[model samples]
Target: MFNLRTRDQIRRVETGKSTSNTTNGNGSTSQFGFSSMDGERQPLLGHQATTTLHAEPGFWRHLLFSAKSSPGTNSPNPFVRWPAQVWNVTKITLFSSWINLLLVFVPLGIVAGELKWGAPWVFTLNFFAIIPLAAVLSFATEEIAGRLGETLGGLVNATFGNAVELIVSIVALRAGEIEVVQSSMIGSILSNLLLVLGMCFFLGGIYNMRGQDGHGHEQSFSTATAQTTCSLMTLASASMILPAALYGVLSQAEEDNKQASILVLSRGTSIILLFLYCLYLYFALRTHQKLFEPEVSQVSDSDTGEEEHEPLLGPWAAALVLVVTTLVISVCADHMVDSIDALVATGKISKTFIGLILIPIVGNAAEHVTACVVAIKDKMDLAMGVAIGSSIQIALLVTPALVMLGWAIGQPMTLHFETFETVAFALSVLVVTYTVQDGKSNYLEGAMLLGLYIIIALAFWVSPTGALGKV
Candidate 1:
């Protein structure tokens, strides 16, 4: 009789009929139906069983299906939906701040170039255009870094965060705008060391000052890390200073061979700096990582709950955005480079001023915004990494790479900065070294750095084009 009842239940399940509930000996209803036979739960069957048996579609199939489906109210046509979906994904990937709104300038800048608009228009539009693209680039880099873990992530951030400067410098280098390339390099370094770092300290200090108590608070970071970074900056300054000094001495005594000698020295120095940068990466990321670690604060259980470590975009999507944004920036940079001469002639602005002040400000704008935001969040260690790390990259990596590139392309790109610019670089490093020596920051130090930057900018504004020998 039990075997016959089991066969009947199987037949019912096969026929997709609901299993009837049975009452147990204890007078309780067994909703599982078969529970009455052994007083134990049994596997669900019939219509419900199909859900468990159903297989999920593969990635390609799902993607194809999504593409075929309507993209909701955005569009009804599949082709239109696909594009809308891509745009939506791009926005999500690149849109981190209000700064992204300036992305509109990208198309405008490209159009201006095609329409043969005046240099000022092309330069102005592309200049603004690169700002938002840079911010997007920064966002994409961070997304990728976040997914890469801490050490590899730091390297990724270090490399790609300065993509704007690298791309623009390369464009200028290729165009034989050697002064623009060199000045922009030093400008990036100075801006990061001074403007960005100062803003971080200033905004961070103010944010921390609003403590729960009446007294103001001071923010602190790893002193070991700060000192190490400052030491590297000093090394970079020495690199710049030696080349300028060599050029100066040789110009007086060996004018015929001076240019060739400076070029050789720059190439050799660039090779060394690049090698040092590599070793520094190994040291920071592998062996001496502890020194660069942020100070961990004690938190209660509630506060210490797990935070989301997920990246905003998938790995491939982030990389795609990075490549696309970089390409766009390259285009805009090329347009800007082509217009630099005309801009200089009409605006009567010194190339030194543009390279040292305007171009750097644009290239480093994303870093500036990022550092300040993190600093305000009291992440001084991260803020410092973004600010000082960028400068170090420009000095030790981008500048040298440009020299090698010039060597390859037969351009006379050297490390010989003008004497005044060299002095500014040296002084800027000196002041920053002093500021971060103690690993503690306050608003006052930030103000002083900003003041120094202003003084340097003013001096350059009145100065004529020097090393490039352009009027």
Candidate 2:
């Protein structure tokens, strides 16, 4: 939850001034301790008020679980309810209404596509409808992640949060839409690495600037995130570069042999990537756990006299939400795919445009919003984890799973991407790896990333007819 501390409290947190209890009107006093760099506590006489910064009508209670007061309430606010802070703002404003409004198109797409109303309308509606459902999936993943600790939470967020992209690829693969599957996966990697991470840093920097001005405090960057992201990105870059290089060389001779070689290489690479992903999970969840932990604060609950735990949306409920949302996304994705054939027949949009730009964007709408919102709320760890983690999942988990699944279905998806896309993929990973190396972020970095994405998008959008090449 968002918190607003009195100037005195802010000063104490900054200066490590001691705090003492002051008698209330009821003759009760509370003790507060402030720690200095030398690990000594000092006591001063008085009370400093803390305020919860925001709240919604009814849902705030459940989300906050342990919060004592809502925004503007006269009662003392104990803990900053992070879930409430993040959820309420997103729900009351853009995410909530945007999701609801877009949902109306769900039936529109179904009806239009099923009834053959027209390819353009059906395709547009299906695309729009997935945006909200993706948001819902993202929310469920975050809620579930909240129950798990950061390491596992991040893994969960990355894996299931990206189920939309996974399902889309699988469905497209089955339908023999190889171009859509490959481009969408590639686009997913680039967008999450560039666009999502960029926005998080940009928004987080502004919030950090404000916090520094008022309280002289900023959320620390996670070194573990930096190391893990760099390693995984390096892996992604190598995976992409190898295939691109191999195809460029080996694919120049016999057409049939080229296809077989590409398929063989893709299958082998998929197994290796999947193994690496499992190893990453093991390292994160089993060994070296402390590296990813959120910094601990020594705030004790005044009433309960215990540490405050993360308020969670119970595991069962979270799982149910995830399951339901994923089902909806799958249904909507099927509808979306149904329109693809017709839309391609009209000669209006290319598969590259839909895969590289439109599909990835809609597929990631929720995660994009959640990551930026969390960053703004000063949860940079979660935000960075979601952004980089999603890209890793796409590269290591989803892409490989799709390739194997394609092989099973006799569609035989390959990592043999267009030359430009392969270059773009490698460059995107390198740029992000470089940016996160210092474990810090700022608005300028975000702007640079967003600029790159725009340039990449335009490159795909403006390609001449048949220039993207057949998959």
Candidate 3:
């Protein structure tokens, strides 16, 4: 049904860690990790609940979340005191992304008018520039959360991390630039693997290097079943990219007549593979009840305490912004399409190369920043989730949609990606999935992932056509 709950559950299953346990009418637990507790566990009494005399048990949750959400505070900003703290963090990040988009859009609009033409370069520069802006925001967010002793980091990333790149994906779809769309897939994978993961490992390594608390060993992540599920799903997604690249670069012997066969093959394979993986994921969760249930039956009495809070923008407003941003990003691509095409040609890059590398890079910019931010806070699993999740989205969803839309547009692009690209993506998933399998990652592993990207980049740069496997 395309509900976010299913998506969230799939993701939780993938990561092997969602604590949203619900009890059924029969007195058994649901697939999620919660157990049935009696009426005594519920905190009651109307007057005390209504008043704020005592701080909740969430003091740690709030402290860690708030301290890390914003910087320059010795403790949680008493002024912005769990729920309000999370709201404060969201407002700041959303506001930054909003301003960041304007910084890119407004200047580019002016330059585009002056050039008497389109200029994706303005957006390009804007996209890249935000990496630094992102770095600052990320660092500040984590540090603030730490100081305030709150843990808003994950929520922050969800709102701005891949969400930003998701915006860019809509942008590429609108541009109708097959090259840009393909490249966006490439960009997204690279940015997640290299730029974001790399920064997290590098910075986290330095932070943990001091080692006074020996807390680097702490990982409250989740079950092996969950991580494996996510890891396998990611591999499935990355693998799906193969036929597209292979067909693109393998041969053009019957280039004109090749279109229909490619479409049928690509579409057929995508649906089959996507469904298979989804089913596999469902069974992995449903069948393995042991994996979801914690061994120690007695959960702490205070664990169910709810923190006092409200949404930053009311539910309707946040939902509206999310929808509106997608629409705007989509429309903006319309102006950039022609300009970006010319840039690729004058710069002597192939359409496949442009699509495979550049577009993904721009599209994934926001996500890259957000992943690194989470990694720095030592939430490597979530960081890897964003990276692999983005890749899966590009492969399973974006690529097929591109093929369909291209057909409707009369251009008729295929899902076939190049061989080198296909192999590289597979390896990227391997590296991340394996490295993160045990719920641990270090700078050396981060370096290994980044090195893979660099090797691929150098190869692409020196290649005759600026992509892989071209004759």
Candidate 4:
């Protein structure tokens, strides 16, 4: 079903550019566009030379559909992305996003039901062990998505990830415990950085090395300047946490409330950092549009169009289920935290250690898998960007969100990071940044990243005060 020529054409359309086919040779002039006269613009000139900037492979799908269907008043993402709105016309997207909502809440409902018996074990079971189950399911969604396409795969991944984050954040708010929530968050970060990134690097390197070509494509570093800059900023923000924490500690004698103030300063740091990172993303995406060179497959012509139809579900029926599901899922996220925390306590392991290493990795497992797959497809830029870009989000955006949320609940937690955590984050960013700066990576670099990640893990294990102690 996947024709080589058609797939090649689809790639071209996806990248959104064309070679200079402005003038054809005399023999191929008709192929370019039929001419009406010997010395005149071709009859099809309007069609052939139309240069569009945002032409993804699905450009025609949306265009053709929009041409036939009237745009409803409720529509937001119109024109080129009208296909995405296709779900609005049917039940698929609404159903998927809403189903994701319920998945987050179901576990919490079970816990509330158990509260009727006033059973402590039930409460503990729900708190410590059950949350990881949801995380595993959430991870499964990503795993399945890898085999699927964007319409289904990507939609599922983004919606579910956001849904879980939205729901759990609220629960953690009410539990009134910074120790538990922050620890889990740290876990998510580790899952993404060391485990997720390391797997991708290993797979991509091995795949490329095994190919007939001597080395997979050697990346040119100039192409990834924007991403590199963001990574460095992540390092900078992370590094500042060390001094900030130490400042609070050292200043505690002069100001007994310095601990409280550290949280304030840390949150402030996150706000400033997110603003800068957003700017970086905007410019990087823009530059990618202008300067990125497409692979050969992206240059060919192909017919990826197909017959379309209305979907299986009705409008309001879809809406109700989605809304209910989302609420349920949100409830479950809080329940998840309880279970995960209980597990940590029962085992007598360091809560902060688990979080710093596990939570982020689990949270971003899907994105990590996608990056590895993208690299195999030879989209090196997108692959590298995914790991580094997402890291920036966790370090800057996610960290800050936790602090602000703490404030909203009348618990003022500072944005100041622990000394060891700050140093580990800084070292990780710097080593990875320098290696990737040249825009070329080999198995060796991937191995080095993994090795550093191991050392980071070992340090976390040995340090009793999280990152505060020398490993």
Tell me, by TM-score, which candidate is best: 1
Cα lDDT of model 3 by residue, 1-471, tens digit? 111221232223222332343332233443311122233432111000111213544443433343112221212344533344344445434443432643455345435634646344644544454343443233233322222212233333323334434445445555555545655665576666566666666665655544467655433334463375455546554545655555566475576555566667766666665565455434433464344332231122134232222112222333344454444444444444545656665656555555555655655555565556555655554555556555555555445555655666666455565556666666666666666666555677667777777787766655655445422
Which wins on TM-score, candidate 1 or candidate 4?
1
lDDT (tens digit, per residue) of candidate 2 on 1-471: 001111112212222323243232223443222221122311110112123343334334423432221232212432343443333333322232246568777788778767877778878888888887776666556556655665666567557767888878877888898888988999998888889989988877777764535754444568776777678878877877787677668745797887788889989999999998888877766586566553343121343233322212334545766787677777778878878877877777777878988888898886677678767756566677667877878888888888899888899788877777888888887788788877777777888898899999989878743687633
What is the TM-score of each predicted model, taking all chains together? 0.80, 0.73, 0.61, 0.60
Global fold similarity of model 3 (TM-score) = 0.61
Winner by lDDT between candidate 3 and candidate 1: 1
Q: How accurate is candidate 2 locally (lDDT)?
A: 0.66
How many pairs collide in each candidate, listed in order?
0, 2, 40, 37
Query: Per-residue lDDT for 140-184 in model 4, tens only?
Result: 343334324433443344334434443555576567656545545
- The whole-model C-alpha lDDT of candidate 1 against the native structure comes to 0.72
Q: Give the TM-score of candidate 4.
A: 0.60
Per-residue lDDT tens digits of candidate 1, residues 216-330?
7888888998888889999999998897777766646566588888889999999999999988888887798677665665112134342232343545667878898998898
Error of 1 at 213 (Å): 4.6
lDDT at position 143, candidate 4? 32
Can you give the lDDT of residue 2 in candidate 1? 8
Show where candidate 1 strays beyond 4 Å: 1-85, 210-213, 251-253, 298-306, 466-471
